[model samples]
Structures are given as structure tokens and as C-alpha cells.
Target chain A: MFKATVNITLRDSILDPQGKATHHALQNLGLNQISKVRIGKLVELNIDADTEEEARSIAEDACTQLLANAVVEDYEITIHKKQTVS
Target chain B: MSTTFGIIVFPGSNCDHDAFYALDEVMGMETKFIWHKDTDLSGIDVIVIPGGFSYGDYLRSGAIARFSPIMNEVEKAANEGVPIIGICNGFQILLEANLLPGAMMHNQQLRFVCKNVFIRCETTDSIFTRGLNKDQVLDIPVSHGEGNYFISEDGLKELQDHDQIAFRYCDEHGELTPEANFNGSVDHIAGILNRKGNILGLMPHPERAVEPLLGSSDGRIFFESLLNRVVGA
Candidate 1:
């Protein structure tokens, strides 16, 4: 088994209402130094694969095909370890 | 044979019945309800993908549902020049399916919006709007949380050059103004057609306004117009 973490975010050119709202809220709370606040999702998964490379590919496929919509979003996957201990 | 309006029902599709009723009862046209799992679309002349939270709008609105088994046949039908209209969530699914370009984003307010909106008919080149004149304003209700439409700059230029835009939210007087743009859509676009013009995806719910009791019958005109083209042919 291999563990992976995926981060999904709106494309740079698109405006994120939620992220902008959050940024305003932060400013109200006195976090004025923050240049920007972009919101995104983090997905964690454990996959069963013989090799880490295979698990990474599977995770990427999930992101592109289902987990993330390529039209307005982008995704990145990172493998935690070579394999998970039973 | 009479024209058959096939309404595809996904697991969470709530507007299928409305669409069916609009086509069958109100317009007195032939209609059928199709299951999402069905792989064959042999007898259908027109396909309608109605709105609601398909796959619970999981992963993304219309992302998971786009991969449904029936979509393979849907794509085939679209390529064969079958008229397919996707409303609200159905529009999201069609975008995710890549049958239509661009994508939907969260409403500018980051909240679900449900209300009546006026849309300017941007084009009437397709069978769907032959009865309406260009820039004709139609009262349509759009209900969705993720209806903000976006497209690349080049894509918008191409859409304009090809006359693929079908509808754009506008003021009651048919003026394109910031106040009338409900969802912060690109150029206030509320709907568009594929390059071939057979496939249409829009954020408004035309089926909901098919009767005067629903506040307006402009939506009825949409269905009526399509039936006219099919029956005339």
C-alpha cells in the first residue's frame, strides 16, 4: 500500500469567491500582512500498488479524471512513502 | 414517427419530471424518461439532461456523473447531430464531459442562488431558438450554487466569431449590465452551444417555467420552438 496526498486549487485566472471572502475575513481579524488567500482542497488516500510509481500514477489519474476538474482546477499529488506498513 | 423527447434521469436529477411534463403535457409533444444506467439511445430524437445534484455534486458538480455509463452513448448521439440540451446541473455535466467547452465556478457570492432572471437571446441559429429573435429577452429562472461560467479569452473570441453563444444574462430591457449579470459569468453568458450547435448547455432552468402558473411561459417557447423544427422537418 502507498499513501498519497493531493492538493486541488482553482486555476490562477479564475476568481475564487470563497477564497476572497476568506481573505476579507482574515483582514478583519487583523491579519493584514497576508497578501492573498486562495482556497483549495486536500485529499489523502492509501492505495494498493506493487510499486510507488504505480501508486503515484493511479493517484494522478484519479485527480485528472474524477477528483479534480481540469477545466477550472489543477491538482498535485505527493507520495508519502514507498509503501505502507500493514 | 413522431419526435421523441428523451429526458435522461441521473440518480439525483430532480428536474427530469419538469422537463418531461413541459414537453409532453404542456407542449403536447411525445416524451420519454431515460435511465442514467441505460447504454442504448437508439429511439431518442432529442435528449434532455435536467438539473439537480447528480452524484451528490461530489468531487465537483457533474464531475463524477459525467463518467456515468450512459454518457458514452450520449456522446455518440451528440456526435451524430442529435439535439441535447442540458439544464443547470446538466450543463455542468456536459461541461465536465467536454461535450461543451468552459467550466462552472462557484457563484460570486459563494452561495446558492434561486430566482428568476432575464436572458438575452444571443443567437437563433440552432433549432432550439428558431422562434426567437436575436437579443430577445426571455424570463428564465436559474437555481444553482455553481453557475458562474468561465472560458479562456481565445475561446470567447472563437465563440463570438462562430456565433455559438445562445444566451447571456441581461437586464429587463435587454441591456448587458453588471447589475443583470447574476453569476459573474464571462461576458454575462448564461448559455452557449457546441461548435456544431446541436449540443446546448445553459445554467437556467427552462423546464421550471414551462407554464404561466410557474410565473412565465417563455420556457414553453423554448420547447415549442424545438418541436416546431422537428415537426416541420
Candidate 2:
């Protein structure tokens, strides 16, 4: 089994209203040092596969098809082999 | 005097009956309730997506509901210019379905809000609001947690260029006031129409305020507007 961690975020040019609101709040709270803020999602998945390549493909497919919106969002996947006890 | 409309009801949908009653009883139109698993769109002139937590709002609001079987038919119908209105959760579903542009994120306050708001009509050319003026104020109620709409700056410009903005926030006196902008939407947008001007997705619940008994009947115009279009056509 392998674990895949996916990070999804809106394209840089897209306006993230949530992030903008947070930035405003931070500025109001006297945190003028922080100029920009963007919000994204971290999704984790467990896949039982024979090869790392197969696991990576599955993760990519999930991200492209359902896990993320390609128009406004982009995603990256990191796969790690799960340690099994003897 | 009766027109048939279908309300797509997912498992967690709680406002299906409210939508049905509002259209049938208040708007004097025939209504049908369709399940999400059904892949049929026959004998329906209008398709409504009522407000509710579909699939327990998992993996983002309206994300799971977008993959439902019935949504396939809804997309086809919407492309053919069938009038479709997605309210609250329905709006999220529409966004997930890609029938409408942009996305809905959590409110700025990161809280669920339920309150009455005033929205100004931004466009009168769509079939949904055929006779309404471009600047009419509508006192409606909104209830949702992820009702904040987000889009790219170019996307916003495109929507404005296409005249697809269906509604904007406005004061009680029908003035383009800043305070009416609830949830911190860009350009004070409250609701919007698609490029074709047939599909509309808004966070406000028109079904919840269709009768005077509900203390506000301002939302009735939305139903009345669509009904008049169908009847006239």
C-alpha cells in the first residue's frame, strides 16, 4: 500500500475570496507585514498497488478527473511506500 | 396555467419540498421531485436544485452531487436552453457540474449565515427575469456556509462584458449601496446567469420566501419571472 498526498490550489491569477478576506483581517489586526495570503487543500489517499508507477498514475488520474478542477485549480501528488510490520 | 418543473433531490437535500411547494402552491405551476440517481429529464420544462447539504457537504460543497446520474441529463437540458436555477447548495452543485463558471468557497467569516438580504437585478434579458428591470431590488433570504463566490479577474470582466450578472447587492431603497454586499462577494454580485443566460446559480433561497406567511414574499418574482417566460413562449 502506498500513501499519496495531494495539494490543490487555485491558479495564481485567480481571485481567492477566502484568502483575500483573511488578508484583510490580518491587516486590520495590525499584521501589516503580511501582504498576501492564499488558501489551498491537502488531500491524502491510500492506494494498494504493486508498483510505485501504478500508484502514481492512479493518484494523477484521481487528481485530474475528480480531485481538482483543472480550469482554476492545480494539484501536485507525492507518493510514499507504506511501511509494513514483519 | 400549469407548467411542469423538476426538482433534483439528493440524499442530504432538505429543501426539496420547500421548492416544490413554492412553485406549485405559490407560483401555480406543476412540480415533480426527481431523485439524484435517476438519469432522466423527460417531461420537465424547468429543473431546480434546492438548497441542502448534499452528501453531507463532503469533499467540498456540491462536489459529490455533481457526479450523480441525474446531473448528466440536467447538463444536457441546460445546454438546450432549459431554464435551470440552483439555489444555495444547488448553486454549489451547478459550479461543480461546470454548468456555471466560478466556484463557491466558505464565507469570509467562516461561518454559516442565515438572514434576509437585498439584491438588485443586474440583467433583464434572461428568460428567468424577462420583465424585471435591470436595477430592481429584491428582498430575499440566504442561508449557507459556503456561499462566497470566487472567480478570476478576467472571468469577472468576461461576465460583465457578457451581461451575465443576474443580480447584485443593493439597499432597501433600490440603491446600489455597498452595505448590501453580503458575504463579501466581488463586485457585490449576489447571483449570476450563465453565458447563455439560461442557467442561474445563486446562494439566496427564493423558495424560502415565496409566501407572505413566511414574512417575505419578495422571492416570488423569481418564480413568476420564469413562469411568465414559459407561458409566453
lDDT of 1 by residue, B1-233 (tens): 78888899999999989888888988887899889899988889999999999989987899888888999999999999999999999999999999999999999888899999999899889888877888899999999999999899998999999989999999999999998987889999999999998998999998899888999889987777777886776
Task: For candidate 2, write residues B1-233 as lDDT tens digits.
Answer: 45689999999999999999998887878899999999988989889999999999987789899999999899899889998999999999998888988888677667788989888888889988886777888889989888778877888999999998888877888776666766767787778899988899988888998888886888898778877788778
Show model 1 residue runs off by greater than 4 Å: none
Worst 10 residues of 2 chain B by lDDT: B176-185
Per-candidate clashes, comma-separated: 0, 0
Q: How accurate is candidate 1 locally (lDDT)?
A: 0.90
TM-score of 2: 0.88
Which residue pairs overlap in candidate 2's backbone? Answer: none
